[model samples]
Target: MLMAKTAIITGSSCIGRESAIALSKAGWNVVLTARRADALKETSLLCESLENCLVLPGDVTDEEFVKRLFNETVVKFGRVDLLFNNAGVNAPAIPLEELSLEAFQNVISVNLVGPFLCAREAVKIFKNQTPVGGRIINNGSLSAHTPRPMSTPYTASKHAITGLSKCLNLDGRAFDITCTQIDIGNAATSLTARMEKGVLQPDGRRMPESTFDVTHVGSAVVHIASLPPDVVVPQFTIMTAKAPFAGRG
Candidate 1:
């Protein structure tokens, strides 16, 4: 029998949950992680089978916790084929000058450092695994390209993720490991629910924005993950049709 591929999704958010279900249904064993045990349990329950799904609740920002998460994944699945770097947090809406240092640090710790640590561990396993490779998909939110009215910390962290993805892609070439980034915009998750209620815009106006289903992200993830080891999708952007993603100030 062919050994099933395995994937780890961070954040345990709606996108992570949907991607877990998508990958599980596609015959890939999945390990889901996040800070919330309840949320991870909920997501794991949505998978194809509890047997194929492993819920490892932990904080991605904690170095020790991230290490343990990857260790357990490899022990359970034998190898990791994909890592969905989706855990992220946004600091409060405040002008750069007014943004608290603590808030900015927290955002960076979760959105930037967390992915870095996870990718590092995943790359280590990818290099040493019998199959000799894996894919990493980072969730670089829309703010990665353009900033909202008062989203300095969040935007900065996401933009940094772009650089991190590029570096990993270049370095992993010889090892057959691949890195991809998906810049998402207004996916209809609880996080984006405020968009429907009118959100602050760059033009200093509160405008109701459009949102697409988060499952679209999950589908994109599966498509990217399904590629052969030699193939790499370096970057992809998915957003709502009407999202203010084109030439916004």
Candidate 2:
């Protein structure tokens, strides 16, 4: 029943791409952003039947570029109803001592700071729209709760995301903007290929992780988007049931 709604999915990686397609199918005009123009275009094709889809290729790290992305979304679709702050990166699995400061900063830049910047832009646009409130769905990871072995960069970034989401939920209240964080694990996608072979577990072990259909993530995102604006699911985690991410991690 969503009508005349628009959304932006920053860093439309595998999960982001799936989320974008789901939202588009649910009748939201979707703007896709990522580093590569070609990849954005490819993701659009997958959502082909959704005529309102547009691709805006750019790096989320650039503040001006992120601002322009929000501006263009409003220009093209009139107003933004949601922002999927899903752009993120993971460093090669390595021990904490082995992780370089540069690597840590890089992960924070994309996985954490980028969302903050995009959310700021979204707040401006939402404040100006006729229905002056919108939803922001952040793409968090399982690592935020319990990290895998030697994943300091990725884990730290996602944990920061948890804090950011909490801040947004409280601060966005006045603006009628609601923020929700989706913590996902081992969703079958190009980004998780290494996990299929075997992954480092917490108990000083290596085991092949279980996988789940990416479409499950796609449908889950849509379910959240379909909810009434007055309702907010603060945080939800979805992952392969058999995936060693629960207490077994």
Candidate 3:
């Protein structure tokens, strides 16, 4: 049987792109969206599930564009089965003292506002669709639990996502559109290259962070998507075993 009748993956950077590829491999008609058109094209070509993949390039930060993507997905695919709100960034990790208002707001816009808008639109679409339900998986961060030394904007936004996810899970019960959060730790990606060298530890010292392959995260996403609608995991954490997260302070 086909899994995820239809799927959407935002970001499509490291883990997002791989998640799209994996879900496409699982026989889901996938729609790949991001601000980069060329990258989306390249991603669409990298799938192996023999499913029709659409590359819709635009900013998730745009409310109109976000709604249009949702509307068009339902028009093209008949319904939306899963939405991976994975578009995010960690703007130059500097001390909070050095963070300008623009920098802080930009991170919040992309991480928090974008996800909020996307989730809202998805909820509308899922409710209106005949099945009256789907699934929304928010890409949260380990920072939602413990903050790093100088990642104020990223940390704050991720922590806020925890609350958003909780609300969605509770409110989505009636519609059968389950909502879940995946708090991921460091994975091997261009964004986390600094981990190979060293990163800030809880004690204010920089230490090298061991990273697991990005495929492990892809595997986790696949597992989350494979679950039956009746069995929803409200929150899940996927991280590197050797990573310094426990009591990370």
Choose the strongest candidate by lDDT: 1
RMSD, one per candidate, in order: 1.0, 1.6, 1.7
Candidate models: Cα lDDT each: 0.91, 0.85, 0.86
Instruction: Report the C-alpha lDDT of model 2 over 42-141, residue by residue, as the tens digit.
Output: 8898884546988889999899999999988888888888888998988988778888999989999999889989988988887778878899899998
- For candidate 1, lDDT tens digit of each residue in 1-249? 999999999977678888898899899999999989999999988889899889989899899989999999988989999999998888888778988899999999999999999999999999999979999999998788888878888999999999999999999999999999999888898988988889987777899999999888889999999999889999999999998878652
Error of 3 at 58 (Å): 0.6
The residue ranges of model 2 lying beyond 4 angstroms of the native Cα positions read 1-3
RMSD of 2: 1.6
lDDT order of candidates, top first: 1, 3, 2
Each model's TM-score?
0.98, 0.95, 0.95
Instruction: Put down candidate 3 lDDT per residue, 65-145, tens digits, no spaces.
Output: 999999888778888889999999777778778889999999999999999999999998878887688889999989898
Model 3 clashing residue pairs (backbone): none
